[model samples]
Target: MKIGLYFGSFNPIHIGHLVIANHLAEYSDLDQIWFVVTPHNPFKKKNSLLDNYQRLEMVYLATKDYAKLKPSDIEFNLPQPNYTVNTLAYLQDKHPDHEFALIMGEDNLKSFHKWKNYQVILENHHIYVYPRITKNIEASQFDGHEKIHAIDAPIMELSSTFIRKAIKARKNVEPMLPKNVWEYLDEMNFYR
Candidate 1:
């Protein structure tokens, strides 16, 4: 099966995430979109995130209704400060029968060249990029790249940071998240 790996911290899964994954699952060639919950993102501060299990549970709750979308903890057991290239290689070795691709936003694509061993990733796997509202355009190096595909997925401006801030401020962000996720957050009093 062709699986698109959508990696994220997912401090809390939200509707914007669901939309993008669902869009790619329905519109793209991918058989499934796995939400690879990163235990710790190198670009983010670990202190700001919830427990890894908590975040993964939220992901499971948010994606339960969708068959094509599934939550993954593939990076949880990997070494801290893990890079995408290593994960790709590991996944390939472990699941030789399945093909894995990447799902990222256009903003991420702008800095794709800076990732560790990005050329190796490009050579082996395809990347599906969704449009993001960013001021700077993508780098010219990616133009006409056969391995990269620009998907006409919805541009979601919603972010987990905004949701966290709102929840801490005691604002009603129920609509931004899935019902199960919202209930779990409310019950746990998370982000407050």
Candidate 2:
């Protein structure tokens, strides 16, 4: 099986995320896209994040109906400030029968060179990059590597940060998030 790892904080899995995952599953060669909920991202602020379990639950609610899209809690057990290289290595080791790839946005690719062991990641796994607003990835920078693929998936300007801010302002978030996820957030009074 070819699995694409879509890692994120998923602070509250929003419609934009679901849209991206759906497009990837429908249009790409990936057999499955696992939404790896990171417990903590070294590049992001820790205090603003919701608890890992809550974030994981939101992902579960958002992806419940999609068989090809799975919510993963693998990073919850991993060490804090999880590095993508380490997580990918561990997953590859544990699931040798399954081929793994990394799914990311064009914005992340801009900073790809700064990531720990980026060269190993590029050599060992394929990177499926989707477009993001205001971030353009230069293909030439990668020297036309066959492993680096640009996917023609739908790009949404929406982000988890926007959703959190909206919720805090008591703004309607139904249009931005899955119904179940919105309901869960309202029920838990999260991000208020």
Candidate 3:
């Protein structure tokens, strides 16, 4: 099976994430899209993140209704300060029968070169890039690269940060997230 790994903290799984994943799963060559919830991202601040299981639960709630989308806690058991290259390697070893690709935003493409062992990653896996509203341009080296495929998915500007802040400020941000995810967050009183 061809799976596209959509890696993120998913601090709280929101509609923006579902839109992109659903678009990729339905429109791209990928058969399924896995939400690889990272326990710790080297580039992101750990302080702002919720517990790994809590974040995973939100992802489960958000993606449960979609057959093509599935939540994965693959990184939770992996070592801390998770890096993309390492996780990719681990997945490749464990799921040798499956062909794994990457799902990322155009904003992340701008910094693709900075990732550890980026050359090795590009050589082994394909990257499906979705549109993002970012000022920085993608690296020239990635332009027209065979390994990187630019998908014409919808541009989602909504962010988990915005949702979290809205909830904390006592504002209604229900429309921003999946209904079950919003209910889960509200029930748990998270981000407040």
Candidate 4:
């Protein structure tokens, strides 16, 4: 099976995340899209993030209905400030029978070179890039890279940061989040 690992903090899982996962699962060669909830992203601020378990739970609630989409807490047990290469190596070692690929957006691609052992990741695994609203990365940038695949997934303008801010301001975020996730947020009073 070909699995696409969609890594993110998922502070609160939003519609944008679901749309991309569903698009990749339906349109790409990937058999499944796993939302690998990172405990802490090296490139992001840890203070602003929700608890790792809370974020993971939101991911579970948001994606439970999708057959091809699954929430993963694989990084929770790993070292803090997890690196993609390490997670990939670990997954490869644990699930040798399944071929794993990466699913990211054009924005992430713009900063791909900054990631730890990015070259190793590019050399060993396929990278599926979805279009991002503000990013303008062209296929020509990765013209010589056969493993880099550009997908025509829809661009979602909504972002987790925006949702978080809206929630903090006591604004309605029901439309941006999945029903279960929103209910969970309401129950927990998250980000308020």
Candidate 5:
């Protein structure tokens, strides 16, 4: 099966996330998209993060209804300061039958070179990139354009950072996340 790995901290899995994943599954060759929840991203600030398990649960709640979208706890079992290369290697080893692909936004595309062992990742895996607000990937520049593909994923203009700020402001987050996720966040006083 062709599996697209949508890796993220998912501080809170919002509608924008679901919208993109759903759009990918509907319009692309991917059979499913796994939401790989990172307990801690090496490149991101960990001090502001919620508990890993709590973040995982929010992901679970956000994606529960979509059979094509699954919440993965792969990083929860791996060592700290999570690295994409390491996680990719580990998943590749464990799921040899399944062809894994990287699903990321164009913003990440610009910094792909700086990622740990990015050359290996580019050489080994296929990347399914999509456009973000400020970044648009030019596929022709990459050495492996055939491997690095882009898709037309609808934008919600909503971000985890934006949503977190909204929650902190005690503003309505209804438009930001799915109904269940919004309800859960309010109930748990998440980001409050």
Candidate 6:
């Protein structure tokens, strides 16, 4: 099976996330898209993030109906400040029969080299990149551009960071998240 690992801190799962996962599963060779819930992202600030378990559960609720979409808690037991290369290597070792690939935005592609053990990841896995605001960096920026693939999907201008900020400000972000996810966040008092 071909699995595409979509890593994120899904503070609360949103429509943009579902759209991208659905698009990749429908249009690409991927058999499934797993939302790898990272405990903490090295590049991100901890103060802005919700609890990893909360975020993971929200992803579970949001993706319940899709067979091709899965919420992975594989990183829960991994070390904090999760690194993509380590996760990829761990998954490969654990699931030898399945082929795993990465699904990220063009923004991540631009900084792939700076990621921990990036060369190892590039050598072993295929990377699928969707268009993002930072995509204008051009392919020449990296020697491993060939390992990265661009997908044809509608670009979503939403990010979990932005959504969390909106919630903190009591701004209207009902449209930014899935209905039940918002309810769950409220029920759990996440991000408060």
Q: lDDT winner among the candidates? A: 1
Q: Which candidate, 1 or 3, would have the higher lDDT against the true structure?
A: 1
Task: Give a tens-digit lDDT track for model 4, residues 33-122.
Answer: 999998888777799988988999999888888899999999999987679999999999999999999998888887788889989998
Name every residue pair that clashes in candidate 4.
none
Candidate 5 lDDT (Cα, whole model)? 0.87
Tens digit per residue, CA lDDT, model 3, 62-157: 998889999999988888877899999999999999999999988788889999999999999999999887675635679999999999999999
Superposed by TM-score, candidate 1 places the C-alpha of residue 32 at a distance from the truth, in angstroms, of 0.2
**CA lDDT of each prediction against the hidden true structure:** 0.95, 0.90, 0.93, 0.90, 0.87, 0.85
Cα shift from native, residue 31, model 3 (Å):
0.4
Per-residue error for 134 in candidate 3, Å, reads 2.3
Alpha-carbon deviation at 45 in model 6, angstroms: 1.8
Candidate 5 lDDT, tens digit per residue, 1-192?
998999988888888899899988889999999999888877877888889888888889988899999999998988888789999999999999988899998888878888899888988999998887774545535635778987888866778998899889988888878888888888899898
85 Cα displacement, candidate 6 (Å): 1.5
- Candidate 6 whole-model C-alpha lDDT, 0 to 1: 0.85
Whose lDDT is higher: candidate 3's or candidate 5's?
A: 3
By the TM-score metric, which is better: model 5 or model 6?
Answer: 5
What C-alpha lDDT does candidate 1 achieve relative to the native structure? 0.95
List, residue by residue over 23-65, the lDDT tens digit for candidate 2.
Answer: 9898989999999999888887799989989999999999989
Q: Which sections of candidate 6 miss by over 4 Å?
A: 140-144
Any residue pairs clashing in model 3, and if so which? none
Task: Give a tens-digit lDDT track for model 1, residues 113-180.
Answer: 99999999999999999998887663657978999999999899999999999999999999999999
Give the count of colliding residue pairs in each prediction.
Answer: 0, 0, 0, 0, 0, 0
Worst 10 residues of 1 by lDDT: 134-143
Q: Given candidate 4, what's the lDDT at residue 15?
A: 95
Better of 3 and 6 by lDDT: 3
RMSD of each: 0.9, 1.4, 1.1, 1.5, 1.8, 1.8
